[model samples]
Target: MTRTDELIALEDKYGAHNYHPLPVVLEKGDGVFVWDVEGKKYYDFLSAYSAVNQGHCHPHLVETMTKQAQKLTLTSRAFYNAELGKFDKFMSEYFAFDKVLPMNSGAEAVETALKLCRKWGHEVKGVNPAAGKIIVCDQNFHGRTTTIISFSSDPDAKDGYGPYTPGFEVIPYNDLAALKNALKDEEVIGFMVEPIQGEAGVMVPDADYIPKAAQMCKDANVLFIADEVQTGIARTGSLLAVCGNCSCENKCERQESYTRPDILILGKALSGGMYPVSAVLADDDIMLTIRPGQHGSTFGGNPVAAQVAIAALEVVSDENLAQNARKLGEMFRSEMQRIIDSSDLVTKVRGKGLLNAIVINDTPDSKTAWNICVKLAENGLLAKPTHGNIIRFAPPLVMTEEQLMDCVSIIEKTLSEF
Candidate 1:
């Protein structure tokens, strides 16, 4: 067997069968590209699910991690570390949140945010402890944790995860009326949503949906929680997906379209894919509800992760990744539309910024999208399918215009094969 086949066999023999990954086994990665074990190069269209927004193995993040690693790594929450305070101050000013609850992964941040919401509900909102409910949208892809999967519409993630956590209400995404009606419940303490549903095939809501929803939540005293784990850090052409059409390069100051969330959950690109780092941010009134001993992670605010995250956020701003994503996204969609105009295989292309997707003209159960992805891999590009029929195409935001057009050409050629 070949090296790729041997590696695949080893994984099949030892690893858990939870993930159905694409066959390619990558070994090396740089900005917008990866090479497999055999050294065949391909454009990295997935960007580790938008975790490597600063591009793979970024020098700044590597330097920060390495420098911090030489000094210290983890001190846990038991004792305060030097980098943690700096991270707290930097992130607070970076995202404009009064406080931050650090965690190791995106799921942990979501859980932390949920716990914070529940705590705020009971302590501040005066809701009965067991009676409070947070509203979540249908087809949301928050995470795979049992509590998060409880309200999931996807059968694969939800089924068999029995005795699921309760206290969450399901509402249709982007439906203002449903949100308005749901807010009428006095027990409703928060509305948790993704500014752009990334995993559900890059679903973008109406232009007015987010701002209007925030206003409604404000009117009803409900906390507007934005889970920007997948869509944040310049993925959706903004510092945060909730920034709306505003294209500011740094921490947003709430422009006309900016829908500021009361509670913000961030992850993925926080460390530029060098280390695990996630954070939940909120103002003093909401975040202070959770005392010191209530919640924390051992490696949440570690020195390496802290410094890496600072470097990563700096990369986003310094490199103008958000602005790059915004400009390139428009270019990409227009190119995809040009292809779709004459093609029969691709029916639609939709998304904002670099986080985009193309719908294969086939049933969700069909293997068309998967086959296309395999072909895309063969043709020197890599992308993955979501919900079977939709193929998500999110590349690193550091890609230049020439590189993007080259990728577009590769995509056009690949689609023609179908």
Candidate 2:
């Protein structure tokens, strides 16, 4: 057989069946395109679920990661490393928080944020320690950790995850009334949500949903925790989706329209797809509750992660990624609307920034979206289905108008075939 077939067989033989990946085997990636093992080039429309926002193998991130790796890599949290302190200060100030808790991955950061909220709830909110409950919205995709999946509404991700951890209340997403009703519980700790439900087919809530929910949280003495793992770091046309309507160069000052969070969870592009890095940020009042020995990760703030993160963040502003996302997102949506209005295959296009999706006019359980994705892969663009019939179309923020238009052409061509 061919090399592609060989590689696929090896994976099928050795790897677990946890993921149902597309058939193409990518070997190299640049700004907006990736080459498969067979030397065919394709646009990477998914951007590794927004992890490679700065683009694959970004020179700056690669250089920083390489230089740091040559000097030092890991120095467990026991002994303070040189890079960690600088990273901490930079992250706290950059994100407009008093302190930051570094972690390894997005899931770890979510768990860290949950732990922080619970601890703060017990200590500051005066909630009974054992009864502390965090409010999570349905259709949220935090991660695969046991605690993270405990309250998941997705049967594929949540089923048989054992007697799931308790203390989590599920509410409908983007529903301020549901949030208001839930916050009335004395046992509630915080309301955690994603500004845009990326994994849930890039679901953008109502224009005022976040700002209103944040205010409700504040009025009820509840902490508004934002899980920006998927939607943060310039992914949603803004520095953070919560930083609504304000495209500030420095993401510190809060706009009246912005929905500032008490606890901000960030990851993915934080390391520019170079290293696994994530962080949870909060003010001193709430952050200080997690005293030493309460929680820690071995590879959380290693030298390489610190350096890579700093460099990655630098690229977001220096390269004007957020503004680019905003401009291109509008263009993308407008083009998509034109396609939708003319065709019956796609029902709608919805999203903010480069993070967007097209709803297929087929049953959720049908393979139409997956089949379209396969055709997209064959037509020199690669995208994937998030849910059953909703295909996410997030490309790297680094893409230019020319490249985006080319991708749109390819998408149009492929859909016409379908």
Candidate 3:
């Protein structure tokens, strides 16, 4: 068997049948590209679900991780670590939140946010402890944990995950009326949502959707929690998608971005994909609800994660990835739209920043998008299909204008084949 075939067989024989990845055995990743086991290089279009926004193996993040590993990696929450406290302080200021709760993964951060919201609902909001509800939008991809999948609209994600978690209400996305109606419930504690639905094929809501929702939540005294694991850290043209149309050239919060969330859930790119780092941020009034022993993780605030995260955020500003994503995203959509107008393969293109997707003109269950992605892989640009017919394209933010145009050309050439 060939080297690639052998690696694929190894995964099929040993790994769980949970994920159906493209048939590419990646061996190394650089700025915006990855090399397969056979050394065939291709643009990494998915960016590890936006985790590698700062690009793969960023030198600064790698250096920080290496140095921290040699010194001290883990300390748990039993005692104060130098890196942990510094990280907490820096993130709090950077994200414009009062406090930060560190976690290991995006899902863990989501779980922490939910628990914190529920606890805050009971203690601060005076809602019935057991009945506090969190309203989420339909087609949301928060995480894979059982609790997260409980309210998922995707049957594939929810089926067989019995005894699903309760107290979550799913409303159709972008339906302000539905959200307003749901907010009428007295037991509602928070509205958890994504600024742009990354997994749901880079769904971008109406321009006013987020600002309106944030205002509504505030009017009802409910928390507006932005699940920005995919859309944050300069992935969506801005530092955070919630930052909206602001002057983020300085990466400062000087400009008004329509609305800001009370609770900010961040993960993925928090450490530039070099280490597992996630955080939930809020002000004192909301964050102080949980007592000392009520919530904690073993490696949540480890020294290694802290150092890595610090370096990662620094890279976002220093490299000016936010501006780059903005310019490249506009170019991508414009170019792809032209292709869609001329060809029957793509129905349309939609997204903000680099997190964009093209809707394949086929049924949701059709394999057209997948097959197209396979072709894209062969053409030196790798991406995957989400849901079925819709293919999300989120390249690393470190990609340059010249590189993006080359990727666009590659895509056009590949699509012309079928």
**Per-residue alpha-carbon lDDT of candidate 3 for residues 1-418, written as tens digits (9 for 90 to 100):** 8899999999999999999989999999999989999999999999999999999999988888999899998877899888988998999889888999999899999999999999989999999888999999899999989999999998899999989999999999999999999999999999999999999888899989999999999999999999999999999899999888665865446657736799999999998999899999999999999889999999999999999999999999998889999999999999999999999989999999999999999999999999999999999999999989999999999999899999999999999998
lDDT of 1 by residue, 2-63 (tens): 89999999999999999988898999998988999988999999999999999999988888
Native-referenced Cα lDDT, model 1: 0.93
What digit string (tens of lDDT, one per residue) describes model 2 on residues 350-389? 9999999999999999999999999999899999997899
User: Model 2 lDDT vs. the true structure?
Assistant: 0.92
> Which pairs, if any, clash in model 3?
none
CA lDDT for candidate 3: 0.93
Give the CA lDDT, 0 to 100, for residue 127 in model 3: 95
Off by over 4 Å in 2: 252-254
**Superposition-based RMSD of candidate 1 using all C-alpha atoms, in angstroms:** 0.8
Q: How many residue pairs clash in each candidate?
A: 0, 0, 0
Over 4 Å off, model 3: none
Please give me the total number of clashing residue pairs in predicted model 1.
0
